[model samples]
Target: MKAIVKSARGKGAELQRVPVPDCGPQEVLIQVKATSICGTDVHIYEWDEWSQSRVNPPYIFGHEFSGIVVEKGNLVQNVEIGDHVSAETHIVCGHCPQCMTGNAHICQNTEIIGVDRDGCFAEYVVLPSENLWKNDPSLPWDEASVQEPMGNAVHTVLAGDVVGKTVAIIGCGPIGLMAAAVAKAAGASRVFAFDLNDYRLELARKMGATDIINSLNADPLHIVKQETGGAGVDVVCEMSGHPAAMNQGFKMVTNGGRISILSLPVRPVEIDVTNDIVFKGITVQGITGRRMFQTWQQTAGLLQSGQVDVKQMITHHFPLEEFDKGFQLMLEGNCGKVILHP
Candidate 1:
């Protein structure tokens, strides 16, 4: 099968033919239909500090995808051949404390596909049947492929109630854009989207942001303050990993509001705990991956029901051989969700 392999410890990947993997007794073999480029894939492509320390080279490295079950191992029971599906990226130990108590998304021994094993940037990939998420047969392949990341947006935005309240999304990346849409669909009175790039901010507007503010041009805190009559926003979804923007998120949320953070900053971020958190009496949540199948269920409902349409946000597509083009757009921050057909 043709696959995009990270052949060396460097800044690029190579398209090469590799042997198709065999399905284990508990795993299933999927024929890749469509896959999406993620920020983590960009980190791996750039060989950044996080990728260098986490991923070993010479492996397939993409996790977001939709595929069809072509073959299944003898013990696989959750799905059958010919099922359309996406997957939960995190593979966890079901016996751990987190897993046992229904918090498997944070299992101590979690193994993420693409990071810990060969990923879906190929014609064929194998995964545990337990991780498979059945997709509606009529769902578009590209849209279905993005459920994993959309799950992240759903988990972050819905961490607290947004209904009838003002919410601020502190980034305009793909997930941030989705958060704007989710907040709007969840009945937020106003959705303020912030980002440095106009291209993404425009996309955020398309995704249902009531107001778009380019943080580079206008002060997000000031604009939000004026818009909200000095009360600030009721809910803040912190998707920008930048320390400065994160601090802005802390400052712009109203007293007794909620702040849910999903971005992973490279370095330690400094915050004014006394004034921004304690005195304001806000609820701060550190969001990780989706809340297991619950977030997945909500994400699927939003997409399937047309309540949160994502078609406008998926701005680009490329063939698997042209993986570099997708990565380039992601690096430049000029595109939304980029899907790759295998």
Candidate 2:
């Protein structure tokens, strides 16, 4: 099997011929059709500090994918061979307190597929049956592959109410663009898209962002205030890890509003505890992965119903061997969702 492997430490990955994995009793063998690049994948590709501490080299590293089951173990009853599927990347410890209370998305002992174990970036990959999401046969392969990251957008924007309210999404990356679309479908009266890149801001427009603000050159807080008649937005989805952009999100959100942070900052960011949070009576949440099957159901429903069409945001495609091209585009932040075909 040919896979894009993080062959060594430092930067970049290589296309290598690796031995096909054996399916375990609880696993299924999938023939990958489409896989997408993620920010975490870029971290590993660059051998950044986070990747250095977490991932071991020479491992297949990609998790967002849509594949067809070619073989399955006897114990894997949930899905059979020929099932079109994608997966929930977080393999959780089912016995944890968070899992026991139905918060398994934040389970204490979570092992991420691409980061902690071998993942889908090749012609064939093996994953546990419990993690598979049976995709609707009608969903396009590229669209299906991105449901994992789209699930993140759905989880963040829908963490609280958005209907008939205003929303500010402080990032225009793929997930952030999806956040804009989800906010619109969820009935947000106005969805503000913020980013330093104009290309993504335009993509956000097509994704249903009511207004686009380039925070690099413009004052987002001032613009949002003027747009909302000084009341500020009712919801702020902070998907940019930049400290300044995050603090701007805090300022742009209305009092008694909700702010969900999905981006992982490299270092601790300073927050004005008195003004941006407590005094304003706002709700701040640290959003991680999708909420198990709940967010999955919503993500699938939105995509299936055409309420949150992602066609506009899925901008690039390449063959498995050209994985480097996709990575370069993602690193440059000039593309939307980049999909690779195996």
Candidate 3:
């Protein structure tokens, strides 16, 4: 099997021949058809502080994938062989308190497939049956490969009721673009997007954002306030992990409005509680990964119904052998989601 391996810390990923993993009783073997590069992959390539602390050496990289189930373990009854599928990357313990309360997405004991274990950038990959999602045959493999990130957008945008409300997304990355589409499809009266990159902001406009702010040139808070007649927005989806953007997102929310944060800030960030939340009387919600099956179902329905079009988000594609090039493009921020075929 040909796969990309991160064999050591601070080393570039190398394409190498590796043995396909065997499936356990509760696992399923998937023949990898398509996978995509994420910002986390760039972090690993650069051997950043996050990767240094979380990822061990000699691991396969990549988690967002879509493929056909080649074999299913005896214990895997829900999914069958030859089924088209995508999966939740976060493998959770079914016995945790969170899991027992039907909040398995935030299980105290969680292991991400790409970071904590072998991932999907290979000819074959193994996944727990519980994490697999059956894809509609109508969804193309390239689009299905993006369900992992699309779920993030679904969770962020749907955190609060968006219908007939003014919504502002604080980033224009792939997930943020998806949020723009979700906001519009969810019936937002007006959707505003903010980003430093003009290219990404333009993409957000096409994704259904009624207004865009290039944060580098203009103040997002002023623009958003002006657009909403100085009342701010009804909802703020914070997708940029930058501290400035996170703080601005809180300020951009109208009184009694909701702010859903999906970005993972790498370090501690200070917030002005008095001015941003207390005085404004805002509702602040921090979102992590998807809400497991619920998010998947909503995302799948959105895709099937043409409410969220991720095809434009996939600006580049490459063969597995050109993994470096894909990672380089992501690092340069010149492309959206870049798909890789195995």
Candidate 4:
């Protein structure tokens, strides 16, 4: 089987013929149909500092995918061969205190697929049955492949009540765009999206953002406050890892409002603890991956119910052999979710 692997430490991945993996008793072997490139994948491809510290080379790395079960282990009963599925990338330690308390999304020991182990960037990949999400047959493979990231957007938007509230998303990346759509579907009275990229800001508008701002020139805080009658937005979804955007999100959020942060900053960002958080009486929540099965259910429901349409966000598709081109588009920020067919 041919798989894309980061066989060496520096930069770039290679398409090489590797032996097909054998499914373990608790795992399922999926024949990957469609997979999507993630920002994490780019870090690994570029061999960035984060990847150097975490990713071990000679490993197949990709997590977002839609595939069919070609075979399953003897112990896998909930799913069977021929089931169409996608998976939760984080393989949690079921015995951890967080898992024991139903917070498995933040389990003490989590092994992410494509990062900690070999993942679905090949003709076939293996995954634990517990992580399998049986995708609706009607859902397009390209759409199903992106449900993993979409789960992130859903979790962030649903973290607090958004119904009839004014909300601002401080980023217009794919997930941020999804959040804009989800916020609208969840009944947010006004959705303000901010980003430097004009393409993404336009995409955010299509995703239901009432106003899209290029934060490079526009004063997001001023516009948001003026629109909300100087009270500021009721909720702020901080999806941009930019330090300035992080600080701006805190300022745009109304006092006693909620701020859910999903971006990971590359460097330490300074925050005014007194004015930005403590004195404002605001609630700040750090969001990570989806909330185990709960967020997955919501993600699937949003897509199936047509509340959030991710099709438009899928801007490019390429065969596994053209992976480099797809990555280039991602780096240029000229496209949204780029799907890879294997």
- TM-scores, all candidates, are 0.99, 0.99, 0.97, 0.98
The residue pairs found clashing in candidate 3 are none
Query: What RMSD does model 4 have?
Result: 0.9
Clashing pairs in 2: none
Residue range with the least summed lDDT across 10 consecutive positions in model 4: 216-225
Task: Give candidate 3 regions above 4 Å deviation.
Answer: none
Model 4 scores what on Cα lDDT? Answer: 0.92
Candidate 4: segments with Cα more than 4 A from true spot? none
Q: Alpha carbon lDDT of residue 261, candidate 4?
A: 94
TM-score, predicted candidate 2 vs. hidden true structure: 0.99
Q: Please report how far candidate 3 places residue 132 from its true position, in Å.
A: 0.7
On a 0 to 100 scale, what is the lDDT of residue 90 in model 4?
94
Better of 1 and 4 by lDDT: 1
Model 3 residue 104 CA deviation in Å: 0.3
Supply candidate 1's per-residue lDDT for 80.
89
Lowest lDDT 10-residue stretch of candidate 1? 213-222
- Give lDDT: candidate 4, residue 336: 80
